[model samples]
Target: MVKRDGLKWWFTVAMVAACWRKGVAAEAQASAIWVMGDSLIDSGNNNFLNSWAKADYYPYGIDYYRGPSGRFTNARTFSDILGDWLEVAAPPPFSSPTTAGRRILGGVNYASAAGGILDETGQHYGARYSLNQQVVNFETTLGQLRAMMSPANVTQLLTNSIIIVGFGSNDYINNYLMPNLYASSRNYNPEAFANLLLNHYARQLQALYSLGLRKFFLAGVGPLGCIPNQLATGQAATGNCVETVNQIIGSFNDGLRRLVGQFNDGSHPGAMFVYGNTYGVFRDILNTPARYGFTVKDRACCGIGRNRGQITCLPLATPCFNRDQFVFWDAFHPTQAANVVLAQRAYSGSTTDVYPINVQQLAQMRL
Candidate 1:
């Protein structure tokens, strides 16, 4: 195989090994996988919310298991695919009435569409569950668990569990850079805004730590400028990435990595913060789509306007028949095909893909 092909094959092997370990780990642990984040991990909460940012219609979930279960993507997201790889079941969305009973045992998804680390971010979308709100909701879940089982059992279940978090993108895209709706960009430069976001995010994670969370799978900001939405809307849309947006994302990601190190080194004892390289993973696929089995790397499979991304997939939008060929399902989300690849990388890949330790190593760690 050529050098590029060899690298791709190496990644494939790592993905395969990561997945294969799930079956083995299933018998060795009593852990669950919890999810928290923005649209990337939102299963269906936005459906019930009054947000304009919703994916409860057709063509949106054209590639999903339930046709359109309100996920932001066209099919299984990183959360679902990662859960499957870890041999942990998909957690019910927190907003779902059915999330009660033993369903919470597996874990629960507290992510929301257009969610952000800051409460004021993404208000244009309406009732998005901010990270604080999600944690507040988690407190309620903890209450429910305490009622359902012994304190020791609840503690055991939570301490060993891995809670994956994917946020930050919307704070930039939906808030600071959101045209004229927000004056945040005028108020804060990229560095200042990044510091603001990082400080707030650190508090949120610390809150989770206070609530008994020990293992955290934190996803960094991806190459936001290359997303079809940014390409179609930003000035750097003409066959190139929006360098400004990418720079902003890099600032946030850098701070996030430093924060992760602090959390692991001292801020929280016995804590495991595995940084998930959402940026590098997406960048790789974007750089060489063919190597990753992707053909349409710059357009949404279902949307309207430039690159089918100016607007999201509308109700009854005619979606591309070849969903797998496209990297994006809508303006701001990856297609299921891409997510499947990222999930494998998140669970077990090199430091370039996942940092400190992958989800597999983090899961098996006794601390």
Candidate 2:
């Protein structure tokens, strides 16, 4: 029999080897995570843009290790948390000057604040990259990848990678909903508006698919009616959400879900489209805040006015110390704590959170 010290040494070595193998397996499962969305997943692309919907100020990254990295949340965004679970490094923003060279191999984040599916959605907010523009940016990234490796190799890399597309919220929140500034509301009803957005969205997805993208995580819009910004408007009664707004957003999400089904019906060969039910997940959290370890679910931890949402968090604004207890970070975005829940659900949740299969399964799918 081996001595106790020898057994201990062998056990430690085995544990280390097992951990190394797990890490390798995770990294091999998904070569990269290409994120494309609005402020919810934007890492810092808006910092480079001349837009008013920026969040590169104090209290934004207070809970993050790298303070104030331009993320709208207090810490990591949904994509950042998902990357941590996948053992993949968070992709630097395409607008970042240092996103060239070997860094392009990991992936690239093309999300921008106030960005929407429609090109004219956030035009009033100044320069913001719409979903179509983000796709064009991805094309540029693909071009750089071709320069670094053979075109076939780049294609293979992308086929094995996962691309997240989260839009539509800004189209409603900043466009259709803001009737004073945009003609979308006057031009089309809710159903017609959703169809128009979906048409544009379908074309954009086809463009990405044409470029060799296979695995897609289509995140549906969340319950915007429950956000502190909407609550501050007095449209919703105290401690209650605006059901009308939620119903309107729900129609868009329903169309988006069907679109995912259409894409998976052999229309796009080798393409696996998964619909992330952001609406359901967020509503679940809201309905039972205690289950998520949140106390202040109605108001924002930062911001000013009624629900602390009349104005978003200002520069050097003193945020709540109990940020983890609050659901909203500012008027719009979720706290890092809430982001953790959203990412976890999308990464390994059931059909109720992410339909068909979650991100973990999507990553393992060898397309």
Candidate 3:
């Protein structure tokens, strides 16, 4: 009788151990993510906001769902892309209507139009929310999440969440290190100005670390010299990329990479910075514009003037012969197709020149 009882007890204990292991495995598989940054990642969240940096207008989301007028409404932003990944990974029933009926992996976009790390730099153009303000907005969003879930739940959500930050373009272009078209008072000296801007950015990252954010997918500076706005100024003889501006951008990106590395080591050991090589990617596309089916590498697909600059490409303005072939949609932004391609490259780790660490690797990181 005693021998039979021992066998039964051991079997019961084994069953309990197996069940506990399964539960842990399930938790390990699930994940959440959040995106914070500027116009590059900004979805229609800014559509409600009264800002000139809005892209919710027609032609913005045209390629995805079709019809020019419905572009921004149907278009997928960076957050949308990240949300899609989280769905496959965690499979969620998210609360937001935008992500409703979709998998419940927790995620939100805190990106804003014309936002930067510093208050002064962000609002340098005119009236706009600085990068610091966006952080505050992120905190507010977190509070709302906390109200809906327990502290432990919230922490778990954030702990598993991978935060992607995309910014610096606006800061270089519309804010510091360039001539402010809107404001006449402030002047920027490129080298000194970038140092100041980066210092502020470091602070913002530190603040987010305090909030339980560990992993970070950071996009580096892109080829700002190749922007249609800069090219259209009649600076490029052949209307090619502006080398001087590109040099400044390169320097800034180098500094940013070093700064992020420092943060990943010193204070935030768990943080991982993923550099998005917009510069090399765009440069390659420009070098082989025809390969991508782009007819005009020097000019924007949409916008006024033969060289394609001066303002945003409206229906009233000159439209491209074939937008699918063009890399740039307007003076500053890329077309939906280009954005999609870039997102794929980022996810697949195919972009060795630009993205040293792809999203797939970033998603798998424990720290």
Rank the models by lDDT, top first.
Answer: 2, 1, 3
Cα error, candidate 3, residue 289 (Å): 2.6
On TM-score, the candidate that comes out on top is: 2
Instruction: Write one digit per residue (lDDT tens) for candidate 3, span 282-328.
Output: 67777866555556666677778755767767744446656656667
- In model 2, the worst 10-residue window by lDDT is 1-10
Whole-model lDDT per candidate: 0.85, 0.88, 0.62
Over the stretch 1-367, how does candidate 1's per-residue lDDT look in tens digits?
1233454476467557756776466352327878889999899988888998888888777766689898888878898878866667788899988899899988999999989999988998899899989999999999999999998998889988999999998899889887599888999999999999999999989999999989999999999899889889756745867877898778889888888888888868888898888999889888888876778988899888998889878998888987877889888899888887788788778898988888888888997
Better of 1 and 3 by TM-score: 1
- Stretches off by above 4 angstroms in model 3 are 1-30, 66-74, 82-105, 122-127, 177-188, 315-318, 350-356
TM-scores across all candidates?
0.92, 0.93, 0.79
Model 1 lDDT, full chain set: 0.85
Question: What TM-score does candidate 3 get on C-alpha atoms?
Answer: 0.79
> Which of 2 and 3 is ahead in TM-score?
2
Candidate 2: tens digits of C-alpha lDDT, residues 1-367: 1333443354356446545866677344578889999999999999999999888889899988988988998998989877766667789999999999999898999999999999988888899999999999999999899989997899889998988889999999999999999999999999999999999999999999999999999999999999999998899955668778898887899999999999999989988999999999999888888776788898899999989989999999999998878889999999987887788789888988887899989988877
Give the better candidate number (1 or 2) by lDDT. 2
